[model samples]
Target: MENANVLIVFVSAILLFCIAFSRLITKAGIPVLVFFIFAGMIMGSEGAGGIYFDNASAASSIGNFALCYIIFAGGMATSWKSAREVLLPGALLSTAGVMITAILVGVAAHFLLGLTLMQGLLLGSVVSCTDAASVFSILRSNNMNLKAPLAPLLELESSSNDPAAYMLTITIISLMKSDGGGFFGYALMFVMQLAVGAGLGFAFGFAGALLINRIRLNSDGLYPVVAATIASFVFAAVQLMRGNGLLGVYIAAMVMGNVKLVHKTSLVRFFDGFSWLMQILVFVTLGLLVFPSQLRAVWLPALVMSAALMFLIRPAAVFITLSGFKYPLKAKLFVSWVGLRGASSIVFATYALTEGIQNADTIFNMVFFISLTSVIIQGSMLTPVASMLGQLDKEDKTLVSRSFTDYEEDIQGTLYELRVVRGSKAVGMAVSDMKFPESVRIMLIKRGESTIAPTGKTLIKEGDTLMVTTGKTEALLALKERLALV
Candidate 1:
């Protein structure tokens, strides 16, 4: 009980400090996640707080769980519409690009770190892919409105790449422990693990979405809880089966997000807030797991590897993989800089520790140090990079100038997002009696930060944004019916 209380107070103080000084930190071009982790280090085992936490197992478990939550949230956050074009390229990049990155960096690490080839590969495997929590947090906070392919590409890559990295790391760790093994056996296991993980993730994601849609509770507060709980389950079940829990969680979120689920908007809001909470929890806990005293042993190697990742390995991967993609040099450079490692690298470092590999502590400390440097040095400069590339704030002008080139030429009826006018009408009418033409359907309504799919019995209230899709002939009639101004 005493420990729990101290934990709460310590976390609360750090969170308060973060909130109070977020703006100043951003201006300094330092990502706040780095500071959150640093705060944990200061108040943790090595710092003045004297917490004495060194449980790699516990840290790994929480970090993995937090990652599941983060990935699933990313899945739910994906727009099936925007994802259409970028799907193939992104998936290819995630799986194949990860393979190339690990191999390339592993070779580089072998010579640079003077370790066994397997150890170098293991290090590469752990940090090869981008970490989602860091990328998502920075992108959203900075409000970097990327073009279609750019946004979805990054989103898809980070969300899906981890399972591959995990599989590679474990395989190499096993090889290191067992003094290497038969290629065929390892290949079989690898293929089975990936197939099972992807398959389960898809099934659970779809099923969970359907289940969420069917469960209509009497109380609104219970809704978010139910959705969040189910998302966690989606992750746990798949992972328990040795499948890809991250993939499963994300797939589940995508289903719930797009399909007409009960309180879709509420679910989005709830998960988003929960994701932020998880981010705080993740960084803090992982931060506490590090001991400053032990890091000095590996600081030289840490600096060497960090330098290689920044100047050579990362740029090489970007240039090689994205050779055919139409991204300008500036965008490519920004992409290279923004591969900020955060909790996931730290978590993978913990995974390495649990595997009992030689130099495990060195890997953990090196990754922890590198993650800090990446977020602090590269992440906070995202806005400036975007501004340099001229990609920042392009959306404001695009919104004004966008045309419905894909819509009907003639207004038989129009799909419009309606903001209910005060004193005009639609105050308390049952939707069925509103006399909106049969051609028109009030597809969805955004009311006071909540999105609702209205049925015939649903009430039409003022100050609501009704997304009504209908025919051209009934357009005026629908407006008249809404306003009762006929």
Candidate 2:
């Protein structure tokens, strides 16, 4: 009981500190994830806190669960309209680009670390995927709005490429274990994983959306619960069928996100916050699993591999895979530099460790070092690099400017606060009865201590605070004057 209490207190304290410290870190132009991991390291056994934790299996489990939501949230937040523009290129980067990167990094590792082809490939595959959390964090933190398709391209690639890297990692591990699978067998497995995952993802996503819209639950809060359940179920079901669960979750989210559903704005907000919490949990847990002291042994090789990945391997993959596309040289170079390996790599490395592969500890240490350095270096330089490449979209402010839902038209407007005063004609009237301007939207209603999503039938009581949005400044002024008359 005492131990459990201590554990609770420690975990909560760390979360509080991270939450409080995040704003400052973001302002400093550092990746918040780096700070989350560093916090875990500070509280580890070798650090001042002396909390001993070395559970690879546990870390893997937590990481997988966190990644499911993170990916789903990312997919939900993505705009299919924007994503479709870069679909072909993004697909190549997520699939062929990942494979090429893994192969190149594998070859480099084979030479640099004196490892076998398979072992080197295993290490390469572990860190192959560009982390969604890291990319999203850095881009959003820096408020970077890349020019045209670059932002969507990078976002799509990072969120979707994990399944490919995961497939590679698992395949390499199985081949190492059995020494049996030929090239044909490996290719077949990879194809099957993607096909099954994509098929089931589309099926479940549409089905889930239909179910949510048709089944009108009593409480608004339960909508997000249903969505959460669907996200987890899709992942588990896909994995059960030997498909790529991560891919399934992401595709499922994208499908559902595009479809109209209940309380979508609230649901998006909920999942967005939940995914951030998950990222913190995953990073901290993985941080606790590592001993910083062990990293020294693999530091040199890790540094070399990290440099190769950033400069040679990632660039080659981007340039080669994107050769058929019409992207400019600056765009390709920027994409290459933005490839920041992060929590996902360490999570995949944990899987390798749990499987008891040869030199698993060394692989984990090397991956940890590589991920840390990649995030710190590439993450910090993202804004400057984008600026230098002339890719920054100065006109756009939001990371995701497009709407993900069918109902929310034009999310890029100015928000206004309006209060319902006593004796106002609008009081005791339903929101639908107001006949507000078409360009205006009632986003939220704050009544006393409770906030409400104002539906058409919702009554506008006196003393209610309405959070509204207008597409133009003139529309906002018109709304206020009209509200005063009401």
| Winning model by lDDT | 2
lDDT of 1 by residue, 1-486 (tens): 998998789778877998688767756656666778887888896786778789999989888878877776777767676666777767766777777777877887789888778778888888887877667656655545565446666766777677787778777777777755676777787787787777887777677777766777789899888877887787788778977676667767776666666666557766777877787788888888899998888888878887788777777777677888787787677667767666777788788788788888888898888878777767777778778876555633221011100111122456677677777577787778777764565667777866664555668777877787776645656576658542
> TM-score, each model?
0.79, 0.84
Error of 2 at 269 (Å): 1.4
Model 1 Cα shift for residue 244 (angstroms):
1.8
Q: After superposition, how far is residue 433 of candidate 2 from its true place, in Å?
A: 27
Model 2 regions lying over 4 Å from their true place: 1-7, 395-486
**What C-alpha RMSD separates each model from the true structure?**
8.2, 7.8
Q: Give the TM-score of candidate 2.
A: 0.84
Q: Residue 132 in candidate 2 has what lDDT?
A: 85
All models: lDDT? 0.73, 0.85
Q: List the residue pairs that clash in candidate 2.
A: none
